[model samples]
Target: MATAREEPQTTSRARGDGLYYGWVVAWTSFGVLTITYGVQFSFGVFLPSIARDLDVSRTQAAAAYSVYVLVYSIMSSVSGALTDRRGPRLVLAAGGVLFGIGYALTGAAQSTWQLIVALGLIAGLGMSAAFVPCNATVVRWFAHKRGRALSVSTSGGSFAAVVVPFLAGWLVERTSWRVLYLGCAVMLLVGLLVASRLLVGRPEDIGLTLEDELGRRGAAQPRPATADDGAGATGAGAEVSLTPRQAARTTSFWVLVSIFLCTWLVVFLPLVHLPPFAEDLGIGATVAASLVSAVGIGGLVGRTLTGGFSDRVGRTVSLAAVLGVQVVAFLVFAVSDSLWTLYPAAVGFGFGYGGTTTVFPALVADLFGRAHAGALTGLVFAGAGSAAAVGPFVAAWMYDLTGSYRAAFVLSAVVNGMGLVLVVVLRATTPAHPGGRAAEPSPLRGTGQLAPGRRR
Candidate 1:
């Protein structure tokens, strides 16, 4: 393991309000996610221009993203494992360099093949370093406050979704798409490289204890206990963490995989194809991009609102709500021909999409425990989120075939409905542990505590 850089125990926590350094780590990670995701999602706004410039078909342009998503999702496993072994600072620094180089090459690509190689493969490899390492590292920093911290960190994508597409829309109108891409390259290179220096892997890594941990444990507390519950419970030594390998061996993990797979398979249909869909309806370029912004706006509300809301209602309830909203959004898109309907549909779509990203990772931590959170979270995200690659391509292919997005929209609703059903049925179908007790609702169930208003 990479040695953590030394700092005074009070180094990041010297704030007057006594804000923990974990928040700093969380927000810093937020900055990186915002920029990366902003540029990624804004690809939709740039798609028409890119397709026109490269003399490529829409399906070909969409395939670039499909390849990128596939490569990025698969690479996340490696990045997450690396984050656990080497620390996020090193992982993020390397990612920044690779990510920047990929964008620079993307801006300069002369052909479809080059675009795929640059953005699809190279940039995807770099992006794999972003979600897993950033969120996973934050998990190591706080225990009891994990869900809140994660909501803040992941909201960068939502915030970026809100702002970046509009910014890209305006800039694309004023400048060449290539120029806009080069600007992103410069920012990713400079921003993540500098920000990585501010990260500390864990509170204990620097000889510091969480405020709640003081006077609670001796010097020899296990790492998992520090993460499973902040300061842990009475006889904290009894708590255990599931390794990524161990997590894979359990049936609950596969159920999570299925839940996420269904949601992610169609989540990107609107984000990647919505702007073009709006344009097909005779909306102006900038206005079409604003459709993306609408999604972002709802996403901001969803993440900020639902992230905390899930803590009270339980993750399953929160997940069901998110999927349910998406089903409605897709149904509206399928049935409505009126352009105005899209605005609300887009907002609802953003709400569901944003909320799922927040709850699922927290659920993984809640179920699997947090000692190897990076690896386990990566596993879930990679296994299911990889399906996100298919949405854009399928939508594009559908558009090419039928000259309408109606069928794809209907398919998306069905898929999201499946995910909702999976989350609902999950609690009952989970197998009992070898010890003859249920471990599926898992970390919460293991503790013999139901969410408020529930009977055991």
Candidate 2:
């Protein structure tokens, strides 16, 4: 019995013979995101079918997704707190169960209310539980490499974007939308089983340390005070332990919330309406669905590239660049007259949208230490969720009013531009370190290095 117990301890502490266990966490997070977001994003593929079959207006149909976003966003803070307090295993397990059940039931809904309950409330809550925890967990596993780690983990959503829409489009061609939900349920079940076995809450929980640049275990170096440190001793750049309440009191925290809210307002507009908009343009269902897949493809590239890019360029610079790309993409989407133009537009928007997911969390970690990462990230997401809740519905309402998506698409571009402005202003205001300190010079200055007890 003692040998058996000791064996488990040895395995936990093994560190994969010099391979950081954090990579395992990153990949496992990737899997969970792939499954969760695959189902979440597939809603677009289902939108046209559901609206046609149920005989509901586009605004009503889009409301289901709005509800889903609302529920998901509202629960984010609660779930983040749970993940922080109890670790991610239980939260993720619950999420998988809810996700599977919610999709399965959504498949059976006979009315709009039933659809809302199944997809919006249940599935949204499940996604809330699963999504934030994965990002939070992966962030805790790496210090200097947090941006890359986040990119790798979140790329799962991009992967899902590529695969799920195409798969759903194809499947819906052969099977009913109901059948698609059943398929989502099965996928979630299988993904959860695999994730359960592999997910680790943190490196310390498994007796490992954060990896340094050389991929060896090393202690974090102290942050040397810089010239700006004396001027802004209480700014965001200083290294100080902060409770969630304390962090909430700072100007940076509220600025992040505003930025998240505005960014996602634009981000989710297309996510919910893109497929339907294509269909309205006389694009075939399969082809329209492929547009979403295009976004996913662009997203996959963006997610992967931005992680490393942000690590090199400052997060604010990288964020502003992607947001600018989104503005251009949305403008193209707003005015495009043909499917050819639409396809390129989708790629641009997807790239920017995917990059936002990567940069925002890293920005949060930069502004707030990882100690309350789960809660802090969740707070940011709460704003995003709130934006998502209204953004699509507003677009749908615009469509209802104008009989075209042109106005909605224009609105998306405008909001993205606003978000870009906010980011630029925020970068100007935030200190490089917590407590208003100037950043120290280091070999990995832009590659996401941080002081001990803090993370970028």
Candidate 3:
């Protein structure tokens, strides 16, 4: 009995309430994250085995892992921009094809070089396309439960981190490494298919609004930008006005980069080195590998808790607490020679590490604005990725030279502590972006109102 206008409005309201396509988008994206990032994270589990079977140096095999991180990290800006322009379905589908091709080709590799190019370069590029775009898209669709939605989506990465590595590691034991690649291809393909069906750039495409969905659900509402938020929200959007050249000119940017870089060096150190480190401590190989599983478990809990809590507390305080825990975890790793100590270290480090993905995005959105968050966060992440590129090689070289991983662990702790200092410095230097709401240029102007306190 609804009139024509009322029917469309009613449908929009229902969809906005997150009763239909929003949840579908969340779960579809979740499948992709769980699969793509899962495969990416599981590299640590396969590192030792790949080295032995291929007769390559551990450092050499580790470089493949480094490549994925580098690609995924460096391409965030481009991918985010592309997602905005084209849409998640195309981005994700293309990523799937490329990722599958990378893995499929990897199955034919006879040398470490081949694996690096295929898994590292090609697969990494695919991940870049799929992962960040999906995240950005999901964030666009659900403002109220953004924390919960993002936490759920990102936890797919953690779940895959645990399940893929353990499952792939076991498969390698029974079949071959090549078969493992095949499995990755299958998962990636399935994810791509799901994305085609479920993914959209934003609720507007489906005639829905986030406020309609989550607002009706009575989810926690994000504070609207007010005069106070203007300084923080300036210069954030799909395309960064400041290229690398202009961005490099800012002291705040460098300080932020320094903080992110130092933290990442330590992040991958434990992620890539933990399995080998555990084995060195007299833990059995399977059990040592299983310990890697714990990292994923810890990440799931950490990201969920941190994302939800940051909504209540401020983003800055939540970030500081998470990073502080990371420092403590590193200290534990540095001194602990036993499995008992190492177990706790893994839990703490994994939690802190995983929490970064959730916290950093929100931080970026808060400081700049979601519009610029994609590109700005991409630039910020590249710094961290660059640091990650060097960490594994350095950790491996140090272990080889010293005949022990203790020094490496100690060094990681020291580096993390340095990052802590940078973060403090960043906090002290308040941003000057005209309150949190920049005056919109003609091309970018829209009807959406800035949350209160953002407009000067």
Candidate 4:
């Protein structure tokens, strides 16, 4: 405990040592999320096996996953709040234990009820810790590098999507699903437990300032952000300190929530429906599956490239660009049935989705400041993240009512357009004297919105 809390000031002690320790935190976060998400996503591969072995209906068996999503999504707010007060160490430790034991229990279960209790409740509780703490902690550690740091951390899920399911399919062919779950339990336990030890809550705890950690003196200062820098939320280096409650009072906070709600609402519709949509057009099952891989690969590329791009351009401009890409992708899905076109559309959707996720947190920190980043980020996620669960279901419903997926695809494009418009509106009309002229003293009292000087 002491060693973890008192992690060496390796990033700031000298430049000769190597890269900043925040990068270490970012990579560790990536590793932990990879294992956690890989295991979580493998649930689909296990679903049919579990249903057959347990003698349950597919819907009955799948209810466990639905419950798991609901539980994890709701628990994120609680975990995020915990991260703010006690730091990530204790939160991650608890999550590791819960996840490990829960998954192990899932392996041993003989009934659907046990599956629900173990995976849905216990493992779901544990899954909540994977995202909020890791990204929020990284935010606390870096100012100039926040976007790139979060991009690295956020890409873990995409990487897992690309690799884990195929790996699970291969492993399941060789062994029972129970055995796979047990193996995953072991992997997640080791990965997350070790990661908990590597993370620190903030650099200040180790006697470092943000600048010192970036580089000696001003040598490591971020190259000035481009003119689009403050377009969506905040100008460079301006800080806002607001608790979750405090943030909730501001229009910008709600605007952010709405923005993400719109983003997430359309985000999963394609991922869930694309396979069938392709198959409906008489594409081979093998080709249909490959489209998912295209999305995953595009996601990996998007986050890797766009995080640094957001750092250079601005989170808002980057967000608008990606959202525009999404609008295009959905329109493609709406208007076309060609194999050649669908492949690129899938990649474009994945790229937009991946970039949106990476930008979300960096924009949060930029607008709200890092002081209450975990709680703030968590609240927005809690409010908006669940939209992912709905988008697919709603799209399916729309498909059921109508004969074709065209309407659903068009609807998604429209919702995506709404989000894009919100992004533009937010960037354009923010009051130059935000919070009104009577606004609180700044150190300039600026945060949440940009001032004119920021443009210069």
Which residue pairs overlap in candidate 4's backbone?
442-445
TM-score of each: 0.89, 0.89, 0.84, 0.82
Q: lDDT per residue, candidate 4, 139-184, as tens digits?
A: 8888767788988998987787667765775676678889888888
Can you tell me which runs of candidate 3 are displaced by over 4 Å? 1-20, 216-223, 226-254, 430-456
The candidate with the higher TM-score, 2 or 3, is: 2
Model 3 Cα lDDT, one tens digit per residue, 184-233? 88778777866766787776675555555543433434554321134234
Candidate 1: global Cα-lDDT?
Answer: 0.80
Summing lDDT over every window of 10 consecutive residues in candidate 4, give the lowest-scoring window. Answer: 435-444
Give the per-residue lDDT of model 2 (tens digit) for 1-456: 885685445444443444466778889999899888888888888888888888898788888889998999889988888888898888888888888888999999888999999989998888897668889888777656777998999999989888888888888879899988988887886678669677777766755555332344343444433211222243323333345786677666676788777788767777778888888888888888888888999999999999888776567788888889999999999898788899999999889988999887777766665667788788879866567788889988998898988988888888888888888787665446665433432211222343322212
If ranked by lDDT, best first, what sequence of candidates would result?
Answer: 1, 2, 4, 3
lDDT on C-alpha atoms for all candidate structures = 0.80, 0.77, 0.68, 0.75
Instruction: Quote the positional error of residue 294 for candidate 1 in Å.
Output: 0.7
Question: In candidate 3, residue 68 scores what lDDT?
Answer: 74
Q: Which window of 10 residues has the lowest lDDT sum in candidate 1?
A: 447-456
**Which of 1 and 3 is the better model by TM-score?**
1
After superposition, which runs of candidate 1 have C-alpha atoms over 4 Å from their true positions? 1-17, 210-238, 429-456
The TM-score measured for candidate 4 stands at 0.82
RMSD each, Å = 4.6, 5.0, 5.6, 5.1
